[model samples]
Target: MPYSEPNSATLTPTAIFGGMFNPPHFGHLHPLQDALNLLSLNKLALMPCHIPPHKVTPEVSTEHRLAMLALLCAEDRRFCIEDIEIRSNKTSYTVETLKQLKKRTQSPLWLFMGTDSFNSLRSWHQWQSLIQLCNIFVLKRGREALLHFPEISEYMDCSAKKPLNEAQLLSLHTQTGKVVALETKLLNVSSTQIRNEIRTRNESEAKISEALLPESVLNYIHKHHLYES
Candidate 1:
């Protein structure tokens, strides 16, 4: 099915992809694009957090991260940027975002996350309440069993079958508090790698091309003298 921008005309399933996006790159973009296409979502919101609760605080300011994110969204109408966390001026939590979203929209809510994040869900603030707010769609490249995590075994839909595939996910009904493990091809790049490369390489070195970071983002980084420190 072809992609469509989100509209209120229909109560189609919508998704949210939240991250620090310190410097949004292919690793972040690829999985989201794949999800949007595979699931035939109404639209996906690209949220930038003010401060991530689990990882080290991002070195760049929220403004710069949002700016780079804006450049990325400019190319695709399917992805929209939401800076709620950045504007909140506090620690970012998944439950809080979902709560706000729940109050505003009646469409089914889907949260896109990687296996790493899904693994550490218990450690997040009010993690248990997460599944209550939206259905979780975890992205994994391998056929990893979702029930392996003892911490969240209770939340897993064991009877649904193992290693849920693309077809199952596409046809599966969206239920609140249910967990779905999805296999997808994701880029193996990280913001750390991108930052290290930019800091080590000179402008003449075209090693980090549009493949790692969007051309517009690369130019924006250079123009703003980001990651120099």
Candidate 2:
């Protein structure tokens, strides 16, 4: 099935949160909600890459990841599950995916990512081109100092001070080829830690908290016995 395109007239300034989503958890959802509110996005797309370029292949299959993401999206209407990467069935690269999305929609595009991932932007395939294709929103994580890459830093717009106004955010979407570091509280949860917890700890001891995942997703993990190996 072809990925359905949104009505450009109805939804403008769409933001995309793409990742492995190995097991969709609260850690992923919380920051996304923050981005939606901060950026004042019309719609935020939860995209799961078919094959991550920087990390090892996810332990769970794409089918399982997609289903978990679907469950996450079910909680809110604003969230959209985008399967463009999965549908392509190729090593997912941000630039190519953005290109495909750009071609389909006239609405402005914003790509959401973590500070850690943003630090390694230089390593991505055609990383420079990716920024030109859409606005980049970097969510700060940890106390790690923000590392600047000359290629992208020159275009970074640090003028977006704390307590961003609607006008500033609107300007970001309308304009292209700039990076903005969003100011929002972020959670410390990680997929690797969650997977290790499930693999090493017994169910009673593991007790996956609602803070880490939705109950529905936890139930699905237990039912499927994911990451038991």
Q: Name the best candidate (by lDDT).
A: 2
lDDT of 2 at 215: 80
lDDT of 1: 0.71
Question: Number of clashing residue pairs in every model?
Answer: 0, 0
Give the TM-score of each candidate: 0.82, 0.86
In terms of lDDT, model 2 sits at 0.75
Candidate 2, residue 148: how far the Cα is off, in Å:
2.7
Candidate 1 Cα outliers beyond 4 Å, as residue runs: 1-10, 143-174, 203-205
Tens-place lDDT digits, model 1, residues 6-91: 44325666688888787998788777666665565647888988877878888887789989999888767888887778778678
Candidate 2 local Cα displacement, residue 106, angstroms: 0.9
Candidate 1 worst ten-residue window by lDDT: 152-161
Candidate 2: stretches off by over 4 Å: 1-11, 153-163
Tens-place lDDT per residue, model 2, 1-229, is 1122345334477679998887888888776676666665647899998877778998788888888889988777789898899998788989999999988878777888888888888888998888777778887654545677655533343322344576665556456666777655667788887788887876564675455888888778878989878
RMSD of 2: 5.1
* lDDT score of residue 28 within candidate 1: 83
User: Which residue window of length 10 is worst by lDDT in model 2?
Assistant: 1-10
